[model samples]
Target: MSETVREKANQSLAMVEEVTAVVLPEPAAANAVVPLEKANKTQSAEIKRRMAEIDMEDTQSIVSFGSAAQAELQEISQAMLADVRNKDVGPAGDSLRSIVSTIRGFSVSELDVRRKRSWWEKLLGKAAPFAKFTAQFEKVQGQIDRITDNLLSHEHTLLKDIKSLDMLYEKTLQFYDELALYIAAGEAKLADLDATVIPAKEAEVSKAAEADQVMVAQELRDMRAARDDLERRVHDLKLTRQVTMQSLPSIRLVQENDKSLVTKINSTLVNTVPLWETQLAQAVTIQRSAEAANAVREANDLTNELLTSNAKNLRESNKMIRQEMERGVFDIEAVKQANADLIGTIEESLQIADEGKAKRAAAEKELQEMEANLRDTLAAAKAKKTGLGDTAGGAVPG
Candidate 1:
């Protein structure tokens, strides 16, 4: 319960105590007897007046106070019933249920930083570990905002209900006080009828004539009936007052429930929400640190792999360089093979040259032979021509 409500309840209790102290006395004093005598006289006069006016046939008219009191009590009961009916807390209960459901729906696990990513997302460099968590955080923050608003609305409702219950509490107390007054008045009226009016009527009935006695006895009977009716009415009022007394605690209980709900709502808004937000922020920061550490670890591994590969390549290149530097520019085996090939080529050329020289010499010898034969044939032909020419000249001269 809120302090204000507690204080109001204390004040109400004190007021009730003060009122009770003033109204309920220990006993009547000796001086109070004079007022009692005067009250009895006044009651006798009132009873006489009522008897004079009341109809013998109509018993309802005999006790107007009881009828009025009963009517008033009924009215009070109906009004209280209406008030109790109107003060429905079903909506408040629903709001509380909704708030609880909203709270339950908030799961920190939804903000898991290690949520699985698709292969393509990783390959495309879109593996944002924080994106899902951030979205979930935003969604949860939105829920918190909605819950805060709902709690505020519920708090308002509870405060209003508490205030209304306070009024109802005061009203119930007032009804109780009124019922007490009614019961006391009815009891006093009944006492006056039994003590003063009925006895007087009985005495008159004995002294009067028979017909007058009959009338007096009828009035006396009416007075007794009115007294019975009033007694019943007072008992009913006491019962009504008992209901009001019971209602006081019921009203306080409802008021206390409202106050407690208000306190819960205020605590959620003031404490729980902020703490959750802070913790969520801390969780995000921790997750980011973990992601950074993982990234650094991956980078270190990549660097180590790159350095190892480069070292392997460097070792291979250095071995090749050392082999090249330790050897001459031309290999001795290659030079020796090249010289053998050159000598074979020169020998083959010399052999072809020798064969060509032999063939040319043979052809020259054949040409000389042909020339000598032609010279011999020319000499023989010349001798033969000279002889023929001499023989022809000799023949021509003869």
Candidate 2:
């Protein structure tokens, strides 16, 4: 045979060997075990071995159904007469005769089997059909098994590759989830600083607006302290952003590597798309979510800087209003103007904050929806993979 044909044949044989083998149950009694252990294994193995050797082309089997008036029937009658004083029927004889007829129907018939068979057929499932066709059906199936055995033999390299691919995906998801969680935490912190803590500190600055010479100095000092605290917090955020950003490229690279694995796993799914295509869906969904998250993070980063600057400006403006209020030259109209300015600042900042929140919420929801889909797809893939393995490895032999 040509190398290609030989390879194909080997592939087919490997499939059978990997996918199908009979296992015997433990013996019921100790004595039975001693007698039956090797015998049972040997018998089952022989059946499979014979099947593997079957030649579909130029193979033939014939079987003949016997007539009721065969030589065995007359011989049975003569043996019965010698055993009995009179010609008679007995329960034992009737049961024996029935058993004999049933056995003869299959065992004593001329062997019959098929001729040519495809390389894809299984040979061992034809035991019962030997009566109708012939044993060639079993023989063709055996050839198919032989071919399957070579391709799917023990230590299949493909299985190892699949496991390696699965490991890569596992790492990819871990990074995706970790990065998402870190960003979410940072967003929460930014929101807290912008909306609650910073605003309260600014309100404190405003309250101290009416200080005299010494008090005005004291108030300015407090304002500076608040600014310093907020600045430090902003600095910390920048540091965190640096760390997270640095890690992102590595994460993205890992995600990219996972794409190749997804391709390999999908090819393995073959016709079982509905069942085993989870990896493809998971990899695609995560990639999209990571992309969206990266975009959102970039936006939020700019917003963070804007918030820091705005807070600083608000603190300075507040300090100035305090100094004027304490100067006793505080006109009623001036106070009103200060209040109006404060309201304007609050409204604009609140709007920006709200928009940021809405965007983050929407992005998070999308991520969550995709996560649910990933789980469902993974389950289907696992089930389908299991089924494919079982079908090839668990077929019974003739």
Candidate 3:
């Protein structure tokens, strides 16, 4: 073969090498199955402790220091929210924010009542954590959402670029075929020209083919550079996707934890606080009633003692008057008048004592009823506390 033909053949082989630049190896399945991060043991443990169902201890604290305990509870919820909010989304920030907007809305009421919580109020409080979790979940979910989009986008772009390169490879291969044929035909003409009178037209044709081969080589080099860039981008995108996907489970686990914690806080707020408040109020009321009843009983006893003394004194005076009459030294009219006044006074004293006794009995009975109610309330509160404490466990696993 002519030196020029040999050169052209070598150039065509180089273009073939450039064309292979566009072809990418299949990414390992292991890459897609990236190991996900687990929830932080410390954070998970803290969540369990803080969000545990309201127990007897919590109820006592709320009852003893209502506002202070509530403030502490609020601080915990706020801290959880803040912690989740502070997590870095890095390049996934935009995607995460967008996702959060579409999720369920979270709203916390700052309107905490200073007075005792009612049964209904406490029940409603249990839902508060849901709001907090919703807030946290939305934030994290948004990041996950963006991460997903990026993964898909990168994959799509990589696939599109690979397809473009494949088409280019085929076109370049065809060009190689045409250049080989031209080189062969040109070499044949050069050999024939050497044997006979050299022709300018044959020389020009060979020269033009050589020029075309040079241009084709440059095109192959440019395509090779482009394919190299595309491959690098694909590889980087795959890694990013894997990391992001792996990170997802960990984030989701945290979200699940947030949900669990919120549920517990709400339970404590609704069940423990309200029940404790009601129990305390009822106890106070019962005590007050008992005190009032005791006072009425004491007053009744004193009244009866005074009435008995007055009766005894009247009886003694009557006995003296009778003795005077018996001794024949008393006025009949004075004795009759004295007897009438004493009888009337005695009847009034007996009537007043009867009314006092009746009132004291009624007060005692009412006091007993109040005490009974208070006892029952306390028992119910205790049972609820025990039940809630037992039921509250760790957050549901993701």
Candidate 4:
């Protein structure tokens, strides 16, 4: 060929290369030539040889070859992928198989030599890595399942313990309420007895003297009995405390040695129980003592009234003198009898008041002790519960 003709040919080829960005081997694969999504051995070797000839020094040509191969690989991948997708669209079993087949087809497509991976490289080519992923995934999933089991079991246990505590709170409240009512009733009864039984025969010295001594002895007996019963209830409350302490470890939060955890539990306990316990106790004490004291004061006022009335009657009777007695003047005997009856009623009332006082004092002491014990046990339970929560939530600390 002439130099000018050859020069023109070369320039034309370069222009075509720039425009198409592909420098194919002369007389390249034709439209009539079949394409394989999977490369045959000979075809793969030719692609490799052709790519090795192209160098970065000839950047234009290499990029052109890479582009053309990529386009060819893309078309092949699409056709094969569609064929595989049609064959399998079920669950995990078919999904895994489809992925494997897709990866094999991709490996065969790499015969184009310049083909690069797509975004689904990990997903489509999962044969080697998927096995390992599946193993670890199952293990992590198993861990989640175990954590779920712990959650359910812990929930049930926590609920049961909370229910027990609720019942204990109610029982404690009942004790508080009963103590209050008992003290009130006892005081009222004593007040009535005091007003009714103080000594109708104080004017009859011998009868009044005998009644006073007997009444003092009976008052002592009643007080002692009430004190004994109160002590017994206090003892039983102590027993309840002991039992609760034994169960404390199961829910104790303190031993975890986490200050935030311990503080949180303390806050919760103080918020939920101790504050209420104190409020209730204070209210009960105020109500019971106020009612009892008022009754006692009222009875004493009645006693003072009776005394004043008797003094008036005695003075009036004295004026009647022996003539009144002979003529039944002023009925001084009726006044004397009334004074004796009032004295007897007052004595009885005083005895009952003393008994009620003794019982209430015992109850207050017991409840205070119970409240302390409750606080301690609740703290323990909270510690345990916190420990359980941490264990359930995270990996063990190194």
Candidate 5:
């Protein structure tokens, strides 16, 4: 056998030893002890006995110890990959975002429960500000309930994913153990072929006559081919084992992620949702108290304005009444002043008449001058026309 093939076989044996140490620990009985060399010889004898049972004409049986192991590993791998591909935490994340958004959308200010009432509404006691707030609260509560339901649904899904990952993790370990056994068996068969079977066959080929030498050599060649094929199969199994080793940790990590998501969902459901609802209830109660206080303050302000306005009107009415009552119906001083005013008015009217007469005479004289100027201008224009006509008539021959 080549050094590379020997090294690979040694590596596979070491891996199998490690797996055996882990899976099947030694008994603690002090009297139960076996020599290492003796144990190895026993194992080699069993491997050789198994190999001997395989017909040289059919080498397939030599590597058929765990023929279905590869297919089983492939099935496990496909299942794990499908799970990894399908696992999604996006819905849970979306549920959390929606919860936050819904909580944010809820606002006491939007409810407008503290809006001031009109004068008529206040007088009739018809204001119902809290009605709208109650209606809006019910709507927001429904949204919160829906979000909680969605969160619970995601929680359930995450839990199921965790369980599925647990199964896959177990399946991977099972395959890992099986591959260890398969590799150990293949390595044992290869070692026996290289160390004992092939050398014996080569010796036979050298001693045989020319006619039988070719047949012996051909059998030796067939044995070597079978050994090569077994080696390649063992190497392929080791690769598959490595894949299972890698898959173990990957499965665990995915399970951890799912478990963490479940924890978050539980926290939100058990702690956050109840606390949020409590806070919301407290907020509504506080808002109602604030609205009541505001309404009282507004009423006080309206009363103050009415009182100030009525007092001002009363003072003005009393002052007018006192002034009217203190005055006489007709005083002598009032009659004398009225006679003086009548004389002054007549004299002023006479002075205005004289001024108007003088203004009319001046306006008549200006108008007569304007008419005289206009007649002179017309006479001059007619004389200029007649002179021009006579000059034209004298210039003509006929």
Candidate 6:
């Protein structure tokens, strides 16, 4: 194959390798396989081995999914589940649900899991123990996101640098080509100076007499100056080639750096990012699953509390109803008799008030008639006195 095609093929192979074999830095906390603080020496060593397995990027690690590590993780998770089940407090149901959900979610069918999986993918599938601590998984999720963001940013910077390197590489090649052309032209000029200009000037000096020697010497001096100028130009071009060769090292370094960055970016894009997305989905599912379990548990507790309170209330109400049913607190006969007596008293009081009102009306009529009779009698007496006074005045005038 041609050199360009061969280079392209190598790049493709490198990309594939980078994608499948991304080796990320291990998180400090996640590397601890178990949460046991006071484990024995043997257990601690075993835990360390498991943690190392988790960090391993090779398929040969025994702790990879479907391997012995899976079984060990399952056993540890089950033990933790049993401990939780035996406990009377804490979000036991929620914790159990989360663990079960994670385990089931991680276990992939043939259709879901591709035949060719990286060691990290296997490790992720085998990490059933992480399900037990949903909170810790969530915390780890944040860290993973931050790391992924940084890797993406790094990839961006690398791409920019690689672009710059490519531009520089092209410019350098162009410079070398132009310098080569300049050097070729300078060499040709040097040949011409030696073959023609120097020989002609020497022949002219030799043929001249002693009287013409001074003029020939001046002409020789000018020819020598021209030859020196040509030689200097050739030397300058050679030096430029040397300087260009010196710059090759730095260019190659940049090219190497560009290749390394490309490999890293490919790794992140294919492996690290995918792993993160899968784990994050698992984490979120576990969180929501735990929350749902806790919600159900809380609802059950509330229902029980309400039921108990209602039962107490019903009991108190039943007691009152039972008392009323068994024996009466007030006399029904007495209440009826009192109500009848009150109606009779009210009726009697109404009758007496009507009679008094009638009497008052008759008395007021009689008093008004008596006052009218007295006014009429006084008016008749005044008229008689006036007539008597009038008769007495007329008799006196006669």
Top-scoring candidate (TM-score): 1
TM-score list, all predictions:
0.63, 0.19, 0.30, 0.21, 0.59, 0.37
Score each candidate by Cα lDDT: 0.62, 0.42, 0.43, 0.41, 0.69, 0.52
Q: Candidate 3's residue-wise lDDT over 267-331, tens digit each?
A: 33234334533543454455456556767999999999999999999999999998877874557
Better of 2 and 3 by lDDT: 3
Q: Give the winner by lDDT.
A: 5
For model 2, state the Cα shift of residue 342 in Å. 99
| Residue 291's lDDT in candidate 6 | 63
The weakest ten consecutive residues by lDDT in model 4 span 25-34
Range of the 10 consecutive residues with the lowest summed lDDT in candidate 6: 24-33
**Residue lDDT tens for model 2, 112-131:** 12233334444543333223
Which pairs of residues collide in candidate 3? Answer: 96-142, 96-143, 122-270, 126-266
| Overall local distance difference test of candidate 6 | 0.52
- Candidate 1 per-residue C-alpha lDDT over 65-172 given as tens digits, one digit per residue, 9 for 90 to 100: 434545654665565567557653566566556656755665656454557777988898773657767766677667766656655655665565566556566665
lDDT of 4 by residue, 1-398 (tens): 22343343344333323323322222211121212223367644443444353332343443343333234434433543443344212232332333234323322212221234555875686433323333433443344333333322332333333333333334433333332322223233233334543332222334446658576555545544443443343344334333323323321221122222223333322242234335434544554565567679899999999999999999888877856567653577888998899998999899989999999999999999998777666666665777855344343224
Model 5, 212-328: lDDT tens per residue? 998999998998887787788778777777776777778777776777677676667666877887887887888788788888999999999999999999999999999889878
lDDT for predicted candidate 4 compared with the true structure:
0.41
**What's the CA error at residue 335 for candidate 3, in Å?**
26
State model 1's lDDT: 0.62
Q: Write one digit per residue (lDDT tens) for candidate 6, span 166-267.
A: 555455544444444444444444565588867887898899999998999887786666556555644665565555544545555644655565565445
User: Alpha carbon lDDT of residue 197, candidate 2?
Assistant: 54
- TM-score-sorted candidate list, best first: 1, 5, 6, 3, 4, 2
